[model samples]
Target: RRAAAAQGTSLYEEEEILLALIGGKDYNDDSKCKKKLEEYCQGLENASLKKKEIHEKLKDLCEVGKADTKCQALKTKVTKKCTDFKTQKLEQAVKNPSDDNCKENERQCLFLEG
Candidate 1:
């Protein structure tokens, strides 16, 4: 998306596949699964925004020749948040594929393997 690009971030290919899957779903008012998926995905998006903010701050600090330890700490936080979000999403997709609109794109749910 344009927003992600503006933030100097990019979605992974797997996320694109996931998006295609979600796009195919019927998002009616009665679809509790869709609602839940939306909420979960929203959380992921917020996490991504936070990561981007951290990156921007780190860039600013680097430009000013700040402490390496501060940058390292921020990088660690970003890495942990990214890892946790990915793991949670993959597990959700595998455990509730339909809820994630992944039923039709099951093959793309690599997390389901092993």
Candidate 2:
């Protein structure tokens, strides 16, 4: 995180969440790392906003081309409280990649964590 921040790169949600999974921080009810999850949420919110802006820009530029659904959906998107259950499950899968069941879970975790 320090390296990335120093380089002007972001820690990103995945990295933060990974840190939480690895017991990098101390917290009560650490079963699900809230701080890490919050970072990811912030990142996602920022991304959703950026995507919305890009979609509008694209729509303006094209005039007759396809507009970005990602942006469009975001415009009318509903914010919801994230359930930590999913992350909890996936974090274990990622850490224990040696497990046979984790093979597919790891693949999925990579996708989700990204």
Best by lDDT: 1
Which candidate number has the best TM-score? 1
lDDT of 2 by residue, 1-114 (tens): 444455564434432233334323332233333343344445546766554554222223222221232222322221111234355565565566566645334433443343
lDDT (C-alpha) at residue 20 in model 1: 27
Model 1 lDDT per residue over 1-114, tens place: 544455454433333233323322322222442443455446556776444554332223322323333333433444454466558665666676564355333332342231
TM-score, prediction 1:
0.30
Worst 10 residues of 1 by lDDT: 21-30
Candidate 1 steric clashes = 0
